[model samples]
Target: MDAAAEPVRRSPPWRDLLAPGLATLVCLAILLALGTWQLQRKAWKEGVIRQVVERSRIDPPLAPPAAGTWDPAADEFKRVRITGRLLNDRETLVHGLAPGEAPGRALQGYYVLTPLVREDGPPILINRGFVPTELRNPRDRAAGEVAGPVTVTGILRASEERGLFVPAPDPQRGEWFNRDIPGIAAARGLTEVAPYLIEADATPNPGGWPRGGQLRVDLPNNHLQYAFTWYGIALCLVGVFSAYAWKRLREVA
Candidate 1:
């Protein structure tokens, strides 16, 4: 046991020496299983995309099945038609939205949320889309009338929340924008408001702030991509393990 080769110390478990060939095979098997799982996920995501696409294509012949805390199974993706007058008097424009509709590089606007009183029941909140900041000041909308019996065709959508970065709005001071249906209905003095809101189809609005009807359905099915990355890492690990084992076998020989 010279100083250069002082028994080439290794721990008890490391020196025990499991079969490298077996370990390499196990690593390969694990990688393949993960890749297969990813393919399955891709199929599932594709099915979801198909369902949503088909739902949006149809006309609003059928009504949304009652109004409550939105059952995804019962009410989501289905088309509905509502004919009612827009209550411009009590409408609350949630601030901050602009597709750069007008001049001045700043895009400040409000989403047009008017309470549409259904003939039989309480008023339902209809988001008519976004309007410019100039139109949202109440003074402008208060003067303009969204009068008469108008028809609206759009998809049923749930109200959104302010995320960690975005805090809940203070409607009293008019300092925020999010489609909080409960908060919105309270702020606008709208009684019997529907729990859900409609993300409109490509329809035009008057004041031209929010550029309404921009209902985007963009969801990526990237399970395959993700799986590929993970499997690639597994492959690299297997390759490295194989090379190490080969060197060890040569030294043992």
Candidate 2:
């Protein structure tokens, strides 16, 4: 009998191999787990988006939340109405942009933040929107005006939690810095104010000097996109592992 024909004893793969294949499998499992986690996150974000849409469609702004009812955490992005007078002389022009004005282009301009003292409610800051670069000057800021009791309807916006890369206004150095609501309020001596600001809706302001009604309610929901990316990576990794195992088996054979 040929020596090859006789049952040539061969060591079993398990007995001969010193493989850490378990670690590779563990890594693949972890990636799959992460992919699943992202999918869950996507679901959570989608639900929030739907809730926001529903709340936004609410007609006629409801009466301002009662006193001691202003919860910063809860009140964020709440649709609300303010029936108050605009204290004209007390407007602050922070950095912003308005193209259809004196500044001419995308140059820095004023964001007219005027206090709307509600007749029987808390004062909510109204961000009327951008003016022009010419209006950014302190004197220009002083000269510009919004006047009298105006029924402004808007969505309550959270304070800007980010800063412009350009230098902040050095108030001590007598410079107009960034558009921080709290800082602006303190400088202007506003009282009994809500921590949120109002961006006016599309209600046309007749006799408009500083136009009232440009609230941007656009929100970007990219959790779904992110979830898809992670899932795709997991699938690709699975293909890689399968290919690797096939090659390894062939080599052993």
lDDT tens digits by residue: candidate 1, 22-97: 7767878888888889999999989877887777666644675567546865566666777888777777777655
Clash pairs of candidate 2?
85-149, 169-176, 169-177
Q: Candidate 2, residues 1-253: lDDT per residue as tens digits? A: 5555666686765533334456556777887777777778877877777766666666866665664776655665667777778876677766565455455555456666778786576677788666666554435444335456667777776667545576666555434545566776777787667767877765654434455554555467676677677778767877776677777667778
Clashes of each: 5, 3
Estimate the TM-score of every prediction: 0.75, 0.74
Please, what is the whole-model Cα lDDT of each candidate in the order they appear? 0.71, 0.65
At residue 94, candidate 2 shows an lDDT of 63
Question: Candidate 2 regions off by >4 Å?
Answer: 1-20, 96-110, 132-144, 163-169, 172-179, 205-213
lDDT of 2: 0.65
**Which candidate's lDDT is highest?**
1
Candidate 1: C-alpha lDDT:
0.71
